[model samples]
Target: MSTTTSNHIGRKISRIRELRGMKQETLAEAMGISQQSISQIEQSETVEDEKLEKVAEALGVTKEGIKNFSEEAVFNIIGNTVTNNDNAAFFNNYPTFNPLEKLMEAVEENKKLYERLLKAEQEKNTYLEKLLSK
Candidate 1:
């Protein structure tokens, strides 16, 4: 039996981040760091545990997930899911949602929520001002 080697943690993080449709800039913003720092972190072979945890949070994955990620394995799973009719019932029930698309949808929903909150706050302040004027 052949043993499989794990990819470098940094490389795995980078690949997962990309697959999740997250830009380095967005990750940096979430982590309170610069985009350049994100780039440097991705190039490093290893990252400190604390920083890795923060990166995992920003990328919406567990640290363990990033550590164990395998691009080839993921693609192989996707390929099999697409080609196998045996699993059609499951796929039909679940609809084979793409992770990247889900991430994008989540981000959009967050933006809308933020905008609505801002608008509500503004309206509340305006009402308060009118009450104060009387």
Candidate 2:
């Protein structure tokens, strides 16, 4: 029998996150962790139970869901659901997209961008002042 690294918990989590259309930064923020920490966790082979619990919550999935996640199954479900004519029934759990959440994400990104731009401008002004003094 061949050994299968396919059961790696980190890989499962990473794949599930991708399936949920979530970025590492988003998950990191939800988990109250640094993005680098999320990246590190994704690269790990195994995570502690407490950390895994936090990750599952951040990902909006149960721990069992993460553990049992299957890409093929996800694709198959999507494929089957999309073929149906009733769009409403296809999404019985929750809507695939949430406009309010998307709007908030956009707002947060814009705020961050503006903050960075402001910082750059401040640095430029400081440099100009130093040059004038010289």
Candidate 3:
């Protein structure tokens, strides 16, 4: 493989990792490697295929997907879809749900449920004490 292609692949890996909100230390922990090793991998122009496969798995992307990744292409696609307001095309092309947002919403709803349950328990305890005193 050309040096340029290898360099691009390494850079792509780094970019995708950052976009996924992953720190080098976090990725290292996930892959059972050292943070320095993760840093070195990010800086490398070429990685062995086995190592590359492990990195891709840690980052939650396919090996081929990482090899072919392009930030500019992603931005262009998003720009076109958002600026054009062609909702149908955009929906058909990419996933609409944000997993993080959904998780946060679920957590908030659970918090509310917990609070209600606590209030009911307190009221029940108070009623039981009144009955016992009588």
Candidate 4:
């Protein structure tokens, strides 16, 4: 829709392909397209819906998959090691949450539960010692 929004998606697509250790030519061949087309896509703000679909399918991702990515995700993953305040400026400008967020939330919840269990066990052990001394 907006120039910034399209650029965000383009960046995401490029980033994912790179993370997968795939070259533009590799992705292009898998999608039955030319390397120039892949290069244009990675550099362009927008691509056709049909081509987008093909790219996603070839990459084993979803159509909405490439479009809804965020740089914050990668940052959150690597402990916020490297960040750009502007990296995600155009992301929420076009809002969408990928599954990774949900997975992270679940992991946090599990950690909390584990912590509570440990604390409860310590309390129980203290109570038992006090009772035995009585």
RMSD to truth, every model: 15.2, 15.2, 9.5, 14.7
- What TM-score does structure 2 among the candidates reach? 0.57
Off by over 4 Å in 2: 1-5, 84-134
Ten-residue region with minimum lDDT total, candidate 2: 1-10
Residue-level lDDT tens digits of model 2 in 1-134: 31123677888888888878999999999988899999999888788989999999998899888777777787678778686566666557966799899999999999999999999999999999999999
Clashing pairs in model 3, backbone N/Cα/C closer than 3 A: none
| Model 1 residue 130 lDDT score | 100
- Tens digits of lDDT, candidate 1, 22-99: 999998999999999999999888899999999999998898888878777887888776765575755466447898
Alpha-carbon local distance difference test for all models: 0.84, 0.85, 0.84, 0.79
**Candidate 1: regions farther than 4 A off:** 1-6, 84-134
RMSD (Cα, Å) of model 2: 15.2
- What's the C-alpha lDDT at position 59 in model 4? 79
Tell me how candidate 3 scores on lDDT: 0.84
lDDT of 4 by residue, 1-134 (tens): 32334455566778889877999989999988899988888887777898889888877889787887665666567656536555663344643776788899999999999999999999999999999999
Candidate number of the best lDDT: 2
